[model samples]
Target: MGRNTRKRRMPLATKIVAGAAALTVGGGGLVWANFYASAHEDHSGHNRTRSAAAQVATIDCPDVGQKIRDVPDRARGEVDGELATMDSQITNAYQRLATTRRAQAGDAQFVQNSILGPLKDRRKAIIDRIQLEINRAGGKADDNLDELAACQGRPADQMQNGDGQNGDGQMDDGQNQGGDGGDGNGVAGPVADDFVDINDVQPNTRDSRNGLAADGDGGSTGTFTTDCGVNENNLFNSDNLIAAPGVDNGAHHTHDYVGNQDNDAFSSDEDLANADTSCQNQGDKSTYYWPVLRLQDGTQEFDANDQGGGAEGNIGKILKPAEAQIRFVGSRQGDVVAMPKFLRIITGDAKSFTNGDANANTSWSCSGFEDRQVTDKYPLCPDGSQVLRTVNFQSCWDGQNIDSANHRDHMAFVQEDGSCANGFQAVPQLQIRLAYDIPTPTVENGQVQNPYAVDSFPEQLHKPITDHNDFINVMDEDLMNEVVDCINRGEDCQ
Candidate 1:
């Protein structure tokens, strides 16, 4: 049989629809009306550049270990202080109670003393609570001491064998051996010649982005930018766009639904012009009317009116200002771009501008700024009919948007009375970047490692201290050193 040769082509309409569908499915379409461009334009007006200076330095593993060991001890100290305070308060209460009882016995018409009987009972209860807490603290402290002992034992075992090599290869036996402690595991093994000496205790050699070793000359710059908009024209699809006040066009509707016969009824500019003509012809006879148009991008546009002078048909009573915002996601490089001071919005005499209605003359015309962008010269719209100019915007420390599928990056509108900060007329895209000099982990010695190390001993033992009041708490520093010593000596420190 002859080979079949056929080329399948989709209709133009189908192709267009498919293209749009693809974009939306991939999160790359104008599903909403927003635009975001790199705010930090280089000299060529293109890409923005961010530079950071990181220092490369060694972090003494032993120091980290020590910090961890100190945590439990600190918590225990706090518990002790609290118990002492409680004791003092109880003593004072008892003294007052004794004096008040004597006075009451002598005087026939004695009033209730403010700081005597009732206070004494309350203080007694507090003292009881303190005692319980102290017991718990003591217990936790004991547990910590036990754990420390176990860790110490591991290294003692390795030291006994004279095998100075640690598990992580960063420390050796001689470096870890101290005092009378034997091999960490309480067992002896063959010692190796590679054992490090005690005097060699030093910082672990590792590269950290924020460390001084990473920052060569420290002459770096960065920039940052924030953009705010409305009508789906910014990076974020702001939630400020209000739903149409009347009935749903299709499946979505409620009791207050007001039917629009022409809903989704127009598909071209000419159709809208025709609708406008019909409005003019009906004149006063028309209770409600709308001229619909299709933009070049295929989105529907509508201009509506209610000539009935009734409450339901008033266009001026329904609209509000819409907004969208874009924020830098990560930290910038050299010459950092500071947060923006202004957010701009468009305003006009139309019933709805950028998906919001100018419902009230006063409401739509008021002008102000939010956050740190407040200033004396409040910019207003050109005609003074509405406030549309840029105003100062505030910077938020934790304002970076994290993509959690909840659309949290979207901006919300702040009402005049400050009632609902989350109330929004639109949503915007949020982006963030880590600031310069911030440390991030990278690969080292063929293994992934944390560039910013934190003390872990306190966190690990926190629950025990919280639960057992009578425990002797271990210090973070002590625990950290013990771990380092164990690792260096190839000991079985738990």
Candidate 2:
């Protein structure tokens, strides 16, 4: 249960072969008994089969959080609580989907009828409450909010894998595994096809260093580094203060936390400001956190039976990072301004699996192969090259609010030419570079061994594309000014 403490156990990957079954519509439901393939090794060593029978991989629901905007300040708390409830509902439904393979195989419509249908009804009630809260507070909720309540079961093969394409040429929807969720793999996701050999990936035209940044004639080139121990105290939580401030287990996944020590679902700005700092410099009390990475080797973690861990399909041994490098860089366009105290920013989309990759901001590569970063797949680093996860936060601030209704409108990414959009100002950008010493997974006979994945919402199926980062600025005024000044002066500082 402690740091680096894992019970050594190799989980066996048992192969399940599909048997003959009929696919038909019976009594207002579709039945495809015994046709769904079980988890097995294929000739190509990829975790998928070319069988014509369709298999339910994961559930896809409209992201209610992203669609609900213009929430009044007075109703924000209630809206956020209901949204967190929605996340929990999705997690529960996914857990059922993962454990009910026999039912899913016996009846193709079991997932839609027993899981997704009830889920939509619950979500409709939640959305109605959200609308009522907003309307009660003098804000108009969207008329189409009910449309977001229904969810559908997507076939495993239709999901985007490392290749970023599926059979129908639909954009990646994160899933790439076959069969019902879990598919006897123990963990729910990150099958062999989800990973790609780093050597096979073509070099991306966009430089890995500034994937989110742009070229500019005049820009601040300086950098500021902050030494924050990589969760040395093992601070972990399943809550996201920015997204679901008052809801416990808000994230539905474990997160490795470093920096302000008092962060939780109930922590307020004052609590965070007064909290102890994990950073080497006491002046910087900002909290940085992201989903914990886990190895699918059958080692149960401290939260193995807990709601956000094994119970939510995020089972495995948690991997502590070898290095956590937190740095602040200047805007690519010009001198940067100091970030406001208590600013909350979330980069990347945690629900990108079903919501699409429009806000997906993942960067995975090996330490030596940093030049070739891939967003859709986890990199299988060669020996001695540690796995790396780099994240770049948005640097364009709207100049007024530290937070927004959806927690995004107040900040934006820089444009192609490195300039902020009209009315937005350049601010120091935060970049997190995390390195892990994980064993390279093997794909022998289509069976993935020792696979690793980031913890994600249960329905997200532990896809690498769902990797995201969270931040809350609690730096003191003077220290923040120093950071801005150092970047503006084109001088590196610690």
Per-residue lDDT tens digits for candidate 2, residues 1-494, read 53222222211110000000001111211111211233222323454343323446678989888877888898998898888888777665665665455466467568778998999998999999999999999999998999989998777653221222223222222233222332222444676668889988777643232247422336898889999898888877777899988777788789998998887878889999999988999999999999999986656578765545665656667898999999998877778888999999999999987888888889899987877888878899899999999988899999988988899888899887788887899889899999999999876545466788999987787788899999999999999999988888888899
lDDT, model 2: 0.73
Candidate 2, residue 96: lDDT? 60
* Top-TM-score candidate index: 2
Worst 10 residues of 2 by lDDT: 13-22
Candidate 1 whole-model C-alpha lDDT, 0 to 1: 0.19
